[model samples]
Target: MTFLLGAASALQLPAYQALVPEIVPRKSITDAAALSSVGVNLARAVGPALAGLVIARLGVPFVFAANALSFALFLIVLLAWRGYQRPDTRVEPFIDATRAGIRYILHAGVVRRVLVQLACVMVPANALWALLPLIAAGPLRLSSSGYGLLLAAVGLGSVGGAFLMPAIRTRLGIGGTVAVASVIFGATSIALVLVPSLPVALAVLIVGGVAWIGVVTTLNGTVQSFLPAWVRSRGLAVYQLVLFGSTAVGSALAGAASSLFGVLPVMVAAGALTAVSAVLLAARPFPSLTGRDRAPMPSTDVPPVTEHDPALQGDVLVLVRWQVAAGHVRAFLTSMDALGHSRRRTGAREWTLHRDRDHPDTWAEVFRVGSWQEHIDQQTVRRTGDDAGIFSAVREHASDDPDIEYLITPDRTETPHV
Candidate 1:
């Protein structure tokens, strides 16, 4: 409940979403990117600890009530707000283009093993939420001091997990390493609950923490293996929601039920829940699509690319080239990830971020508007704002040269499949 209040306020704060209107009003793709960013920044600034402290120091009830009052303020302001007319960039393309990549990493198999293993491990290990603290205070007879120490061990282990993943994988083989780590975490949590002494419990928790790192690093590296450049952020966010949020809720519920009963009963219950989750995951559809399978694999043997199809054209077929600034290549393409939102405002058929893979620092954003005039207007407005950092802040920048090539060739491609 307390956590929800903080999350809501962080997202709802007027100071944050105000950035949205700026970009949306200008038919710029940069608004959603900037606005989501502002909200995130504000949360970071007011360190939630202070807010949580303030809530706790005050009456918890009042804290929640005041949060509600603040939300009312946000809604009142929003109700009065007017949005700009969305620009339309609809176009009949000479090429149908939504160029995304599906290149898999060399260690793709190992990384996949890690992703599945972590998801499986998370289903069980996370259930300690309702049970662990109770065990710490009740079974281990630890004061808050010992609990804090235990938390530190976990934090340290997570940091180590980030750095030690590759070495761990090489030593254990991906599947063996993750499986061993998962067992340790699960067994350690159970041991922590059963152990009678605070010192013993703490030792188990430190071991658990070390294993936890192995779990986290394996999962993180696995995700990086096949993420498309365009939807990278969204994909990560969705993974967090499904993998973290679902597991967290499942754990909390199990822990609460176990607390109401006995620790042994709760452990048994958690194990059963994990077994069920494992079955469900294994039964899900297509657990094995790699990047190479879904995308057009560019290879040396593929005769000098010659696709003239409009709707089926890949990204490379749209714009020939562009220049960008140094050090802004990643950021430039990242900003283009907001293309869908920008497309709505500007009525663009497509908003594209093109990057040179050979020199990752090179990139450009290509806008396809229905009418060439809207395209011209977008350029004129941004070119003027180029000096104000208005375009820089909201418009995509490039470490490579940032330029647009408006194709003048008449549409000649035959109609594709309906």
Candidate 2:
């Protein structure tokens, strides 16, 4: 029962996280993310102390009951929220959708880079959060209250950092801010190991908390910025999977290392790794969000098959034939290569660029989608404003506008569109 409840709770997390991008304006997405972090940190600061008090006054059963009731209240509030409406979309089979989402992230350069950087920083950074209680009890010889105070200090620092994020981002930019934060946190981790004094440790934790919030919030915003509405939930699910997976693995490893060696030695090693990762990642900074990354542009083209239900239709094939001048062939091919990445990232199952054997000037771009509905969704919601520029560039190289053809399987079974 406990495992099932936990699993159910975890399933809703991505949807809740994805809601922030949907509710807020694109321009203020970074600030909104910061605000969300602030709420989490604020809860971290308050919830524990409140829970302790409740546990002392009441019993463990009462505390658990209260927790269940709180969730019930949350459900009530969620159901009452009628402002945001989800876009109408045909749901794909779970496994196929999951594969498509994974494919899109793997193909997209910016999304891939963000996930890699997040893992690099988060793995080592998790040491402090996961092992701090053990350190407080064993090494520092602090009481439970003292440890709570230390956590409170960290939470306060996170709140401050959240409030200051916009200014820091404006001055330093996202990459610079993350790099500085990582270094600061790494240094603080080392300091926590060295410094035995409680007051000093609290100060170090405050700095560490600020740095933690900065890196996490920035990474969150970066991921949210790049994802389109169609794939936002799935993409975020993958991001959260990486995040929690890394933390779990890091914590387990850190625990083993601490047991083998000592807490201080393990912490110092983690700190060093974190600092090095920050420097290495800073060299290949995360891509900044342009105006184009804010939202996907809707395509003007109508769906090819009006007679058939898109959901029932199987594998879509799209071919575009471009007439290129002999002199522009090389340049056109170069542009097409870049465009191909965009195509694959935006739900194309298979993409290929072909040159005509008979007429060397003629070029063909072919791609496939899983279904007609998938193709429609890909055309309408998967495309970004930047894609328009790419298409325009390709058209510029062509003597005339490119000809497009859509093909589907003949044996299409009619199923009810959900």
Candidate 3:
């Protein structure tokens, strides 16, 4: 039952998270992202104290029964939501889709940077949340209700932070917000280590909570902003994977370190590491998303396909031939390099660039996709409005419009029915 509940909780997270950007307008995404944290923080503030009271009065079994009923109510509410409709479009096979999602994240520079920062910040910052109960029991010598109160303090602080996030973000920008939040969180961690009394620790937690919400909401919004709708769900899945994975690992490591070296030393080390990481990451801050980044750039120029063409056709090859002046070869190649990333991130496989030996000014860019339909999806949905500059750069260096060709190998195994 425990395993079932855990799995259900994990599965529901990505689904709800993926729906946020789709439901909210693009202009208000940052605000929506911050407000989403508000809901979670509100729950944190209320749920624990309520749960403790219920457990005290009603017993563990009754609490579990109530939890099940709450889940059922949640399901009913989800079913009644009428805002979203899934499009009737062909999807790639599960394995292929997974591979493409991974490929996209690996190639996208901004996504990679965001993930790195998330991992660095989370690994150290999680110690406070994971070890607070231990601290209350060991150092502050608090009862269970006192520990619950400490948690409620953090939650209340988070709620306040969420309300304040928009103003903070407008003043500081995403990178600056994350940097400031990291430093604050690190400082709070150190303060928690030094503080002895229950009241002092609770005060530190409130500050820590604000910093926590600031960092997380900024990171979440940035990731959503960088991704187009086509890959948004998959990209967010990867983001959640990293966020949860790092926190879990960090908690375990912190626990072990505390056991060996004592709690204060481990926390001090973690806090210092988080602060240093913020400085290093801020040096090459994550890129902000422009309006173009959020809008899709569906191609209007893909050649018409007949019904005879199979959706599962293997390895559709694309060749783009460009004619550049001798002086422009370097510039053309540089632009093509950027274009290549766009292609790969969109689902292209086996991408390559080649120069003609006989005609020094002629260059050919080549790539393959798994199927004809996949290529069409790449043309229609995978490209983003941000790619216009990349396309224009390549065109600027070309003598004329580049020639494009699509090819596929014949499948010999199929025989038409007589």
> What's the candidate order when arranged by decreasing TM-score?
3, 2, 1
CA lDDT of each candidate?
Answer: 0.48, 0.82, 0.83
RMSD (Cα, Å) for all candidates, in order, is 15.5, 3.4, 2.5
Over 1-418, each residue of candidate 3 has an lDDT whose tens digit, in order, gives: 7899778767777667777777787766777888899898888778777888999998889888998898899889889989767733356789998888998998899899989999999999888877888888888898988888888888878888988888998898888888999999999888887877888888888988899999998888878867777777789889999999999999999998889998889888888887777886658977666545547767643344433465458778999888899888888888888899988998898799998999987889999988888887777677777675677788899898778998886677878569
Best by TM-score, which number?
Answer: 3
For model 2, residues 132-245, the per-residue Cα lDDT tens digits are 998899868989888988899899889999988889989998888888888998999999989888889989998888898898888888788677777888888888888888
Give the local distance difference test score of model 1.
0.48
Q: Tens digit of lDDT per residue, candidate 1, span 1-418?
A: 7798657644344233233433343222222332333344344434354567877788578766776797789778767778643322233232322211011221134323444555666766676655666666776667776665666555555444544555666676544555667666767766665656767766776677667666554444344333332223333443454466657776777766775887766765564444343343345422342323212122221123333344433222235244556666566555454433333232345555556778655555565654444333233321121122323433446333334354543545766567
Ranking by lDDT: 3, 2, 1
Off by over 4 Å in 3: 56-62, 87-89, 301-308, 414-418
**Each prediction's TM-score versus the true structure:** 0.45, 0.92, 0.93
